[model samples]
Every structure is written in structure tokens, then in C-alpha cells.
Target: MGDTDGAEKLLEEAFYNQPFNKDIVTLVFSFYMDTADYRKLIKVAQRCMAFHLADRLCWHRLGTAHFYIGEYQSAVLAFRRSLEIEHNPKASFGLSQPLLALGLYEEGFNRFEERFVANPSINWIRAEKMHMPKWQGEPLAGKSILIWSEQGLGDSIQFSRLLAVLSAQGALVDLILHPHHSDLEGVLSTVAGINSIILIAGNRFKLQRRYDYHCPMMSLMGILKLTPAIEVANEAYISTPASHKNKWFEYQERPEKKIGIVWSTALSDAFLKEHPMHAAAKVKKSIALRQLEPLFHLSHCCFFPLQIAISEEDRQYLSKYDNICDVSEKLSTFSDTAAMIDEMDLVISIDTSVAHLAGAMGKETINLLGYVSDWRWQQNREDTPWYASMSLYQQTFEGNWEQPVNKLVRLLQ
Candidate 1:
């Protein structure tokens, strides 16, 4: 903490001494970026651009700051200007995010490939070892294709709709997924065209059969020419086993409106250190247990905690509420969470896997988002095209959940 304070103080003094110096400006901007201080980054970026009007790096910094704040239009313009000065792969990739967020599907989808090309350390790229050619929207009739899961479990669930599409195209679809997601085999087996589901053995994948082509699950969006509506329309695609649903029902007493709530997102230590902006936003997304006091005042509504893990502080805080059922112990896997969500009238959650699960399952999910949410939620939207059954309640101002929570309270009433 002292080192951080000292570094910040030095940067501030440098900026004050050489207000128009590009090097000092760059250093200060980088400091704010590393700290995930977007507001300060914006102010510094604007000041830097005032003097270094022709600097491509300054424009790139400005664009990144705007992107983090959910200002897509400004981000787009800033990125474009940076590119006009010098064609940069990183800047090009940055441009795609805002384009996708604004629903410019074609351009965004086309440019999204830059992510893999620019950042080789991305999880999907690291896991991939296949030397085979990637399928590029070609006719797959009589061709065998492998679709491998990438990113988070929620991403795998959300993109699993493409398996049926691949099957419909007459391609033999073989899926490779994480072993932990084995519970989904029964659910996904029902998709029309899947020939087999293979789980990754430890960190390595061994395939029994060779395929003509392989594609990452998310690549289907661009390769298959999918529209947002088509993506969200597959509401009945994922279903909880009847037995699991029945078990959940028997386990808990029924309420008029059983609202499943997930307060905080799980973040690994390494991930938080690597992505300070995401870490900062995650802290903001974690609404305090006491902040939800207004919802408990409503009649005939019971809140079920769907988080898999909770901090000791949170556990002790939740002990105060009798109406809020602590089901964290019972939620051992995604399947268990799904089964409970299957019985819920409404799911009120932060931007987490639970929101994705409820959305994919076609549950009426009210997803609470931070001021600047994930790109999937898009910008300034109440409803997402990614999930027809999901309604987004975003923070109008940073760190303020009062408005969205009050909206939720009114809805519950």
C-alpha cells in the first residue's frame, strides 16, 4: 500500500511538472490503467490529447478509457483515429469490442478474430493444440467437425446452441468439454446432430477419432452467420433433468415467487491481478447483503442464495436473514445450480454464471449489472438479444445499486 501510494504521488508530481510532456502523460495514463482508475484515466487521457494531438498512443489510451466506461461511440472514434495514424493490431482488436457491443454484427464478428491473433495467451488458444484446418463457413455436408469448449462454463452453455445448428448442416459434431461439465452430457446429448461428447482428461485432450475440421464454440457466431435473435431464441435448448428439478422442489418449501439471487462473482487471485479493471468492476458488482434489505420487505417472496462459494464475512452477514435461504452448500456443480434455477419464478443475480445459466435455460432472469457491464449485455439496454427471457437492470451511476434494486423491488411488489 505504501509503495502504491508513493508511486501515485511520484506520477502526480511528474504530471504537474511536465503537464505537456508525452512521456510523463503516458506513464501517468499507464499507472491509472494498471490501477483500473477509468475516471482518472479519462481525465489524464483528455489532457494528454490536448497537447499531443497527433499521438496515436494517446488516442489508443483514450479509446480504452472510453471503452471501459461503456462509451462505445467515443471508443469507436478514438480507436479509428489511432488506426488512421498507424495501423495497430491491438487498436484494431479494441475497435471490435465496441462494434460488437453496439450490435454491428458483421464488422464486429469479422474483426473479432484479431483477439486470437493478437493475444496468443487467451485460454482457448492455450488449450488448443490441433494442427488441423479451421472450418470457415463452408458446407459441412458429410464432413466431421470438432467443436471445443473455450472460456468460462457459462460461455460453453450459452454457445452450445450452435451444436444443433452444426448437426442441421449435415456435419458430424464432436464436442470436447471440461470434465467438470460432464453433467451437461445428458442435457446436450438431446441436440439433434451431436455424435459424441468427450471430456478433457486433466489439462490434455485425447481424441479417439480424427475430424476433418475443428472450430472453437464461439467462432460459430461468425462462421454460421448467426443473428442475435437466433442465438437467444433457443430457449428450450437447455433443460434440467426432471429428477433434479423434482429433488430441488422436495428440498425447499415452495413460495409464491421463489427468487434465486446470486450476489457476488467468483474471481481467481491470478485473474484479479492480471485484469485490474475487471477486478475493480467485480468489487462494484458485489452488492452488499445489507443493500438488499429493501427486497426482503416484499410479501410472498423468498430469496434463495445460488452462489457456490461465499466469504466468511458474507456468510456471517447472511446469518441475520431467515428469509434468505443459504443454499451455497447444496450447489456443488453447475447442474445443481441449474436444477434449483429450473424451479425459480425469477432469478435476480449479478453479472455471473448464474445469470448466463438462467438466461440460457429460458428462465425469467433479472440480471443486475455494474455501470459498465460485460460486452454481452451490450450498452444502455434493458433487455439483451443474447437471452430472450433475461431482463438487465444496470447501474445508471457507478457504485449505485439503489435505482436498479428499487426497480426490482417495484417489480416484486
Candidate 2:
């Protein structure tokens, strides 16, 4: 294999010789994109764009590179440029996130429809939704509406706040998410206006019967024409079952404050392989369990792992730490985890379901965010209206958790 430096030199020579060649620019784009070299990508992308101004791919590349570097405004322009060139669902989906991140919710939600067309997991669901009368902005008095979840648990939880709006309007709300979330049915039933909760795989014909309208859970925002002026109805949403209130821990009570820690997300290999960019972004969202060794040394705190389970590597690593406790054996459901989080003095989490769960439950949560995080986290803000009890600790540069970790140490001290 050629050394990276030499390979770069050869690519540069080729680009210099055939500056206008689409193939050469594409190669250059791939080289930088795979390497996560956003700055060089920006330079190469701009060079290509100036020559091939009409190229939608170049504009898309430019937008993604800008997005990676946390330049929301520039990313918006570049994605829009790509869209203006052609009707690219990829570009439209790309445009939506940064638009929302920049706090342009109305425009962002308008373009967000393209996600269902561009993303593999969501695209198929759209066809199923089309069989039902899609909810438009209409009066919901005495009407029954179905809201089906599209994404991960965290996404469902984040958007579930909007259900209260439906509740206020005298609409009967029913939910249909994945079958695996049946454990959380007890939890979802607690939401203000929800009449029933069914797993997508369970009682489908019965659940789908005679609805006035049905909507993708995320589309509720767009349907509501959600904007900054419209305050999101966030009152009395998710809560844990009262039966799970009893705390169970091996160690006896100590003066040390109990902290729940979730450092990473659990994702399927197939999903990661299918969405490489999402996989890369997911990589940025987590802290290596090894990287959290310093926090484990805090004698004043006894840490508990709230993630579904620890990896074998992390499990072995935990053998060396006494303050951090393993209690995953008791956590069999989201409801179980919610009960435990209710007992904690605080919860520290990365961009994972636990973060959303803790935030939704109104627990004191310190959410750790990467430089470029989920659109919901947005950019440059310590507080989110989505969760009143959550405080954000964001990385100053991509993949560097040192500054945020140091700040967290101070906060805990």
C-alpha cells in the first residue's frame, strides 16, 4: 500500500492535471471524507465547486463538510445550492438538519419530509403511512389520530412532548412503535392523552381500525407548523411505573452521591454498515469506556452504569475500578432503567436513549454532546427547551472530551 503522504501527492498531481474532471474531484472528496479531514475537504470542495458550479454532488459534499465543521449557516447555503441544481432528496434531507439547528424550524420541518425518501429505514415506512389518511393541520375535536414512531427510542421520547398538544385539542392519541418497546408501554400510557399503546407487530388490524387521521410521529411538528412563536406543550409527559420506585443496590448507603453514567449507544452492525455517515457521527457521540477512567476515581461519587449492558472490553476494564458499580443485571426494561434513574442523585450521559429518558423523567441530567451532535441538541447552547432538567456539556472540538470532562469534574466537586 502506498504511504498516505505519497498517495496524497499523486492525487494532487492528478487533480492539478485534470482539474475539471468529475472523477478526479470525486476521488479527492472520498479521500478527505473517509479520513474525516473536514478542513481539506472544504478547500477541495470549493475548488471543485468553482469549476463545476452546476454539480449537485459537489454542493452536497460542500454542505456535509461544512456541517461536520459546525458551520450551520454555510452548510445551509451549500445544501440549498445542491437542491437548486436538482430535486435531490439527499440534498433536501441534508438541508433540513442544519436549518433546524440554526433555529429555522418552520423551513426546516418543510424540508424534513425528504428524510423519509432518502433514508433507508424511514423510506419504507412512508409507503405504509400513505395507506392511511395523513394528518394535515385540522381541528382534532373528538377525533382519533394515530401516531406511529419512525426512529430510535430517543427520537420517539424527544418528540412525544408534542402529544400533549393533541391532548389539549380533545384528540384521542394512540401510539404504534416497535414491538420491542412493549416493556415501555406502561411508561407511554402515562402520557396525557394517549388512549392506547401498541407495538407495531402486535394487534395491527385491530389498532389500525377506523382512525380519523394517522401521522408519522416526527411529522407532527410539520403538521402543527411548529415555529419559535408556538411554545411546545411539555407538561406532564413520560413517567415511570409507580411499582418500580424501590431502589436496589448491593452496596449499603454511603455519603457519596450516586451518579448514573451512560457513555455509549448500542447499535446493530447492519444499521452501522448501511449508514456509514451516521456510523461515523455515532462514533463521535460516545466516550470510549476507557476514556472515562478518570471519572471513576472520584471517591465522593459512586457511579452506576445505566446503559443496557457493558461491552466485554468495558466489563473487563471495570474490574479495576471500585467506585463504578455494575447493576445492569437488574435492568431488563426501559421502565426498569427509569426506576433506577429516579433514584439517582444525577445522570451523566452521552447522546443516547438514557439521556432522553432521564431528561423526560425530569431527572437532573448533564448531557454530554459532541461538537456536531443530533439536530435536537442543536449548537452552542447549554439548555434545551425539550428537557427542562438537562444541562449540556459539549465538546469544543470534534472528538475531544477533555474540556467538557474537566468542566464536569468541577461541577461535581
Could you give candidate 1's per-residue lDDT for residues 1-413 as a string of tens digits?
69989999999999978987768887898899988787788887777666664478878888888988889999999999999999887888898888988888777877777777767655442434666778898898999998877667677777888788888888999987766556566556545567888876565656787788988888889887777765435565677755566658664567557889988888876889888876787787789877888998775887889997788888888777666778889887677888888878889999887888888788999999999887777878999877889999999998899999999988888
CA RMSD for every model?
A: 2.5, 2.9
User: Any residue pairs clashing in model 2, and if so which?
Assistant: none
Q: Tens digits of per-residue lDDT for model 2 on 1-413?
A: 56877878888889888988778888988877876777898888777757754488988988988888889999999998888889798999899989888888988998888887787666333436446677887899999888877677888887877887887898988887766555667667667677888665643344446788888888888888875335874433688877766646434365689899999878766887776766777689989987776787788998889987578888888778878778877788888898788778999999898898898888899999998877777888998878888999999987899999988888887
For candidate 2, give the lDDT of residue 144.
Answer: 86
Q: Which residue pairs overlap in candidate 1's backbone? A: none
* Each prediction's whole-model lDDT (CA): 0.80, 0.80
Q: Candidate 2: which stretches are off by over 4 Å?
A: 1-14, 120-130, 179-183, 202-208, 227-230, 234-236, 247-254, 269-274
